[model samples]
Target: MAKQLIFKTKYTEHLKEAVSSGKSLEFYKSKEFVYDKKQVLIMPNIEAFPNLTSSLDIKDDFKTAVQIYEAFKGLEPIQASDERFWTYLAHVDLFLYMIERWPEVYVGKSSNPSKYLLDHWFISSSAQSSLLRHAISGLWWSVYLSVDEAKGENKYGLTKILFRQLDFPTRTLGTYKLGRHKEAVLGILEFIQENEDLFKTKFEDKTRFVTKHLNVVGGVKPIAYYDRQFFKSELEKVSGNISAI
Candidate 1:
């Protein structure tokens, strides 16, 4: 029989009671939104063995924990033939995939470069560091992939969606605020990537015009109104004048 591992936080019994009584969200949000730099971290554990060739160096535990937790929350606990098989691959694969696929998902190293680092995951200096990092990376990658200067969406409406998505970080489109929007963004990115050269040339040539439109749309605060006709027209104008410089 495979051993079942249950997870728990080090929060005290009183904190747990308060959390269970619906006070956790406030604490969570407060801690997340207003935190100091000199705070201790709390995360999952990593079991890394030394590779004799490279000597003994510790790996990141926080990242491994978050990835595993995120994946688990996404995948859930499964009663498989082998328990170890269920977790080991899922944990490693989750982190590797996030790091490799998303340009914005950065894994930080220890401050002391000379130290043999073991912890992969790090608590942000502030309470909101985790949320901020995740949000920034997601927005950057999404914007990088979706904004097509060549085939600009109908009035930069697409751009507005991305930025608003960043600002709100809500869960309307099946993505929680500051969480991954893997499939939707992936689809858009794939389309943009396939036409990289074409789009790049267009964006570069009409930098001022394209940037103007982007700023206007982004600067529109809440982005309450988006005119499709304007987006289509601007995109067309920019697209037509691009050259492979």
Candidate 2:
């Protein structure tokens, strides 16, 4: 267990500028961009946090999310949303993980490496889209939104389903407002779990349909105020429709 640390605001901005202007490319190539001790601020009253591990498959995001959530389980939503905290992790403790997971950015395969760095290595905003897009914070938020204690031993069942593929979190949930609500996310996952056969293939297309359908329903109704059951029922309405196509 170690004390949590975050980048000082000025350094955070400086790093962002460095990445954006392509000044950090050589450092990335050399694998030598280490954070200066003076640039970090230790968080008060927080401890027992461990460093994150890197994995090759997108499915491994579930494990990474669980690891991060357990380490910082007590974090308030506002604190978790802070860019300083996530940026520090991205640039420091999990720097290798970022490089391993996003090798294209460093290898120059990405058409716009600067934008890739800015998007994945930094927290762009407190918005759901931004939180879900960041390489590290996105993993934490995925578990945060979907973990259900009532599931007892299978608390992360929905989390597993969400990471069964990368697109569900990065594309589907990140792009939609419905993802901001826990109930909606759990409901969608529940629907998928209940009808596993339907989603065994074409998972991305079906999940996108589910989110779009629910978003339309949310427009006419206070879907956010409802529970997970409401989302399951709404999804069921389109189950037959999805099966036909």
Candidate 3:
């Protein structure tokens, strides 16, 4: 018989904790929010996904959940109806498990009470598989395991795209994006493609160099050095694309 995979109980607890500490429903009135691409509000709670089953999307989804809590007291009804929402819930289940059993997932500490939630693997299982079937395939994981310093604000850049109805192709955007801002991230890719010499000398060489001289904890400066040129080229290439902004 095939073994069953269940979402650990702690995700619900974390959800509850997020609600307790987040902004009240009334606070959302001051901001504008859209529900399922329909209902609009003054302030809205938004969730983002990379449309995948990897750690990148999982982390992005958690950020989305927290953002929604900040703008509204309760989750909008439409979110539950959207297929992506359910998809994310499943990914988080895996992430929650990874957080408990694997230490590397916890990159930084936060004072937020919701961060403390944990789970224990209750089942005796081996080599679990991804739940996402249609539309979403493979276990969503971060392709860029290591961070780059000058690659713009990758976290924020990723957040901006995920929150919106992705304008570009998911496959294109998913190809190792960089930058704190949209221009920066898109620019890097554009630049790398435009400048072949830079790609070989600056981009490829540094990738090898940084991969060697790296420490996920303390290698910020070196990462920045590698990313600087690509970021600049990224800026010059697609500077006029209105949709990118």
- For every model shown, what is its TM-score relative to the native structure? 0.27, 0.92, 0.23
lDDT, model 2: 0.81
Global CA lDDT computed for model 3: 0.31
Residue 138 lDDT in model 1?
27
lDDT of 3 at 34: 14
Q: Which of candidates 1 and 3 reaches a greater TM-score?
A: 1
Q: After superposition, how far is residue 176 of candidate 1 from its true place, in Å?
A: 18
Which model scores highest in TM-score? 2
Among all windows of 10 consecutive residues in model 3, the one with the lowest summed lDDT is 123-132
Q: Count the clashes in each prediction.
A: 10, 0, 19
Q: Is candidate 1 or candidate 2 better by lDDT?
A: 2
Q: After superposition, how far is residue 182 of candidate 1 from its true place, in Å?
A: 12
lDDT of 1 by residue, 1-245 (tens): 22223212232233334434544323222212222223222222323321211221124222332333323332221221122322222122223333332212132332332111101111122222232234222222333333445553342334443333233221222132212323333333333344456555434333334334434544553322434344444345555443323
**Which stretches in model 2 have alpha-carbon errors above 4 Å?**
48-50, 54-59
For model 3, residues 21-63, the per-residue Cα lDDT tens digits are: 6532221222221123221122134433322223333344434
Supply the TM-score for candidate 2: 0.92
Model 2 per-residue lDDT tens digits across residues 45-64:
66734445543234467787
On the 0 to 100 scale, the lDDT of residue 63 in model 2 is 80
